[model samples]
Target chain A: MIPVLEAPPRAPSLDIDCELAAAWLVAFLRDEMIERRNVRRAVVGLSGGVDSAVTAYLCARALGAENVTCVRMPYRTSSTDSLDDARAVTEALGCVERTIEIAGAVDGYLVNEPDADGRRRGNVMARTRMIVLFDQSAKLGALPIGTGNKTERLMGYFTWHADDSPPLNPIGDLFKTQVWALARHLGVPERIVAKAPSADLEANQTDENDLGITYLEADRILSLMLAGYADAKIAARGFAPADVALVRGKVDGTHWKRHLPTTAMLSNTAINEFYLRPVDF
Target chain B: MKLAIVQAKPRKGDVEANFAALGEVFAQLASEERPYDAIVLPEAALTGYFLEGGVYELAFETEALAARIAALWRAAPGASRAPVDVVVGFFENAGGTFYNAALYLEIAEASHRIVHVHRKMFLPTYGVFDEERFLSRGRHLAAFDTRFGRMAMLICEDAWHAIMPTLAAIKGARVLVVPSASPGRGFAAGGELESVAHWRNVLQSYAVEHGMFVIYAGLAGFEGGKGMTGSSALIDPFGDTVARLPALGAAVLRAEIDFSEIDVARARLPLLGDLGSVLPDLLFDDDLMPENVRRGGERPVTP
Candidate 1:
């Protein structure tokens, strides 16, 4: 485990011009789908969160409302407000909407393992949602557009091979803070943006409550650390040392989750070492 | 001199839209504290290169294009310090013939001058390139004086020819600027674009061999289903990459180049010093060849 710093780092300015960012994201989504993927339709999993809402909005603008589909995968413990927010996004964007409950699929596996904890149950739910999303993708003949933001990705806050399983992601580069900014820019409802961020894995669980650090603080430290700043320098920027260490530890510990499964390199003709091609190609 | 290379995507067949985008980029750069002496944009930046049927309509006259570009520079936010020279690629319409050309503009406080226009000499006609079909080819290859220093411009294919850079160096050019719109092709096993790697090799060789600064500004984003490799870079006299923009995106890369490096490298290598003696042998001469080969009818014996 990485050692904890003495103090938390101050939040750095990570503001992005919403109009320019919206235009770029819209173009990227449209180009990646039509030019690269050869598909005009897009499917997004909306959890009544800012990331998904903003991604769905951008997709609607890119591929048009007729080409975008918003899927809501709610568990038994999922909040009613989450469902409302997801529906609101689809309605506002004038895109098609579908809701497929994961309670039956998740409980089918959990029934055999009575001692399965919240983390295990949550993984099962996330993966089940992914399965449903992909199924709906096939049914709708659209690409699965991901809503995972950069901050959550860098800190390994997302479930491996589950929430990050989409083929194309528009918000993967934007930090969580930037996503909120963009959400507001895209005219996303204030209720969704102001709501406390949650994975909805369990009842009454918030992301900050679980991580023990605000995204503003985490994003600042992560950006600095990724930019090649030393911990000493980051600490000098008024970040609490404990929060810094915790954020650093999460990023360092989850390195494996960010990349493809490591293949043993016994020969030069290894898969990644030879016969490589871009996924879009 | 400080130079900035803009790796940007151009709207195909829309010169007005591209000009507006370029103006925004210039304004963004001007707002920064970094002082740039020269700005290099990608080949056919004003009118995208792959416009097979629209080249005639998109091509601009030199005088009108210069006036519009001057207005953009004049409207930039930064106050005038030293004259910032701009090297931009465009489709030029001269006497009803269209040519792929690079226009060099020297922008001053209240006025701008069109210094030199280097038309692309070698029109590529093979494999994804169909330049000779629509555009007329250029004839001359020469270097011209700029506010920063003596420089030469090459549009895409011209830089690939050895004679172009050699001739530019012989013409007392210390800086070689290449504007390209080459499509991205072939990915290596490690997921790197092979076209970018190939360009780095090609550009670096010219910089190191001639002991001159080579600036290669490649277009970014997709055009006609082909992704342009945006490896716009500035290579120093020592063949070191001073600055490089990331591939497949729009960016402005800045770097400071010391002109003295040319003198320092040439003094150490002495390749240019021996060129005078080697030129005589390189020139084609029928008498220097075998009798059978010189007749142009018979094949010469190997032995």
Candidate 2:
């Protein structure tokens, strides 16, 4: 739930009704948006970091501490730091927590598949985590609340349907770096925010390490690009040509992943138009 | 004209329950001898939204529901004298595809006609909204040539895109109706609701800039897993709230909006014509943003 920043609406002529934000947005999303729709409980995959930390906090806030549960499914290659962080976060958020060590689970799954690239292995771990989450969500009358931040979403840093596919995402728009900003705002533990971001599926595998360049750099580049600046202009904003090229390429490659599968329109009228009518009527 | 904006919670995934709730409200209004000019409801009223299905599955028993609703509307006080147009939100199945639609029925005819159907054009994928996953977005804008006046209605996200309302206004719409199931603020640490002044002001600005009356009907009460607060109301041509719902559920706020105010605003400002002349190429990125710079300027677009 992105706030209005207590600022005026962009259109001076239009009033944004931000008072409703203070009065309604969270309650609407928490009670009616999730619960009335049959999401009786919320299941979160806590990584112990600020993004997940904040997401967990918000889940507890929205669904109540009892209805909020966390699964810390660590792999064999996962870090002890992540486990500790996860525990700390769950404790702080005041939600129920469980640990389902996935080494045995992954071994069973990998028996049919090749080990392949370590990167692909991480994705496999991620997807495996989702399988557990969805199954639990169903069994417990809960909906998975995703913790992927805006930076991860924009770069396609997450496995498709893994860490995505939440009934509701509380922090999907804030960038990784901005996530830290919001974490501070939410009174998140500094130790969690101070550390580098990792998928925790392997050793020495931080997010920026996999992609190259820190979130601080990536967000800066992304913001410039979204602002509709020319590539050279974005480079002028203080990015190395190679850095800009890499991030831009990542965005372009990931763009299709973010949107619906496009259909070729040979006829004047399309059969399935997703956006054609007004909302309230 | 007496406009009644109904802000209430519709039972999620239960069309029969929702229609019954609406019927209860209508019956109550009918007994009060209160002649309402129009009864406006929240977006996608009958089909509690976000069902996991394709458009075909979303197809509702609108015809049967309409017949029952039309009867109650016709019998409603002042409906025949001045005429009451019951504007409702429902799932409309067209050629096996369902759309989020607004059905307007004139109580005098006892028939529910689609005077306007604003399919939400911009399916907000971000935030809590997942319109793209369920409902089909609208293609063409719908403006109603009603007994009340030339009017247009926009579905939730459609209001975010001024293009729909602008097209309707060009089609002679003097008033705009927006119905939304907007995610509202939750109970925070301080027990404080977040600020939504930005969006409320946006509506006011839309009304003022277009020199048209803007009526927003929001779904109130908790639905799904979240709670909702009703701020449903009207923004006159002068960008002032004429009437509004007081709480989150089952509120009926009424007001008399003057169309002459639109005419006066148009005569005074006339910003639309000037706004139309602004060229896309002339605008730059910094021309927008409207916040602390997230990043520096752009590099260049590589071919």
Candidate 3:
């Protein structure tokens, strides 16, 4: 009989300070809004999950609560508890709130394709939510803030160009564990912080269950890999070989999603080559 | 010896505010059980470097500024517990002339001593730097004795010249402290900043050539839309980066430097011994040109 492999023992702590992380993100968001984006207002899609909740809180702190607009976009299959958690965050942050139902737009696309799989429906839902968020951003004169964390982004857990289409992201550099740490430091609700992370795209869908890996183990492996550790060395550190192979495959497969669109170079002076200016400038 | 290198973003034209921020970092360090022999800060850490119109107003008198830093050090909880030296950079106003300077302060029990001050010799005046327009150049370069060893100080541009570190080595300095306010520029294919790679190369070359520990402490944050690359690092005599801080934000990095590595490196490769023979031939020569070459006339072509 084959034995089941368990994850390696967790590291004691990540190398981060919640207080400093919170302060830096707030300052970065403020600078991005006032200095770079030239917009006084910011709009964030607040899911019940920790990522969006923390992002909304940071936006509220960076820009004033009056200038931040929190949007809760839920599909028909989205859980009721997720909406309640989103409302809890908006009320706690004292920001303007809007609820945009994405069920009609998503189902309208899925109606013709009755045999569509779960992945297709999930992509449609994510794209529909993005459309609503962007349209609301134009109406409110606010820039859309991204809520994707580094862990999910690295593992290709998010729909490319759909959930990853925002112009700016505050927590993009932070891992999932770091996000929870910063969320607690920023006074996010304990219930929201403790809740299992989910996309709420389909019924009874949890991130860990879908990915078949807990965030704690995934973050530890990802950090080591990103720090230039080889796969053999990572597996020698007590991580299961299957887990390491899975992570390496995901990261390698998602390489195209993380970069800008490839442009064919026709001349010496390309668009992004010769003519370049900093985003802030 | 244990050392802490701080890469901080100074509020432009605000000296007191920058001091307060440094004071907070010191307080935080004090709470830790770790003991450091010295703390190194970036160039012009008190006042941002690119202040075009406010140079004179922000320059500090040596004694007055020393007293303020002494007060902050004495107030820190670790000052009484452990004797720690601080190396910081600031704009100096002496005899109505402004010069970029590095100050080394020794904080002992109940006393804050101003040990040495090394003004920057090379004031960069090219593209983004115009230090000569508002500041006077330093006239001398020397190494001083410290608790760690004989250490020398050099501001940003001074370290760029290979001759400056050579001079320090000639003066029996084993450690070189460089405080920099370099702006970030250029990008490579891997998306890493070119300035970071350039600075790493510069630091490694000096450390390997001199068999000395090189500390490159740089500033963080943006001023006038130009961001300072905060790749503050500690390099061993073997040219390996022992410790490094990230490139964008304010951070305090701590690492212990082993002085005994200098002896090991020097014994393995005696570059200094080779320099002893090479210096005289380069310095004492009266005529470096050929006899046929005249002062003002064109030289005859050799057949």
Considering DockQ, where higher is better, how would the candidates rank from best to worst? 2, 3, 1
> Whose TM-score is greatest here?
2
At residue B75, candidate 1 shows an lDDT of: 84
CAPRI rating of model 1: incorrect
Candidate 3 reaches a DockQ of 0.02
Q: Report how closely model 2 matches the true complex, as a DockQ value.
A: 0.11
TM-score quality measure for candidate 2: 0.66
What level of docking quality does candidate 3 show?
incorrect
- Candidate 3: segments with Cα more than 4 A from true spot: A1-13, A273-277, B1-303
Please write out the lDDT profile of model 3 over residues A1-281, one tens digit for every residue. 89999998754345565665566567667655675457889889888889999999999888988999999988888899999999999999899999988878888889999999999989988888888878888998999989999999999999888788988888887889989988998999999999899988878899999878889888888988987889998889889989989888888999888977888988876765544323332
Q: What is the C-alpha RMSD of each candidate to the true structure, in Å?
A: 15.9, 10.3, 13.4
Among the numbered candidates, top lDDT falls to 3
Q: lDDT for every model?
A: 0.83, 0.70, 0.84
Superposition TM-score, candidate 3 onto the true structure:
0.56
Candidate 3 clashing pairs, residues 3+ apart or interchain: none
List, residue by residue over A36-58, the lDDT tens digit for candidate 2.
Answer: 56565888888866777877766
Candidate 3 lDDT at A71 equals 90
- What interface RMSD, in Å and to 1 decimal, does model 1 have? 13.9
DockQ of each: 0.02, 0.11, 0.02
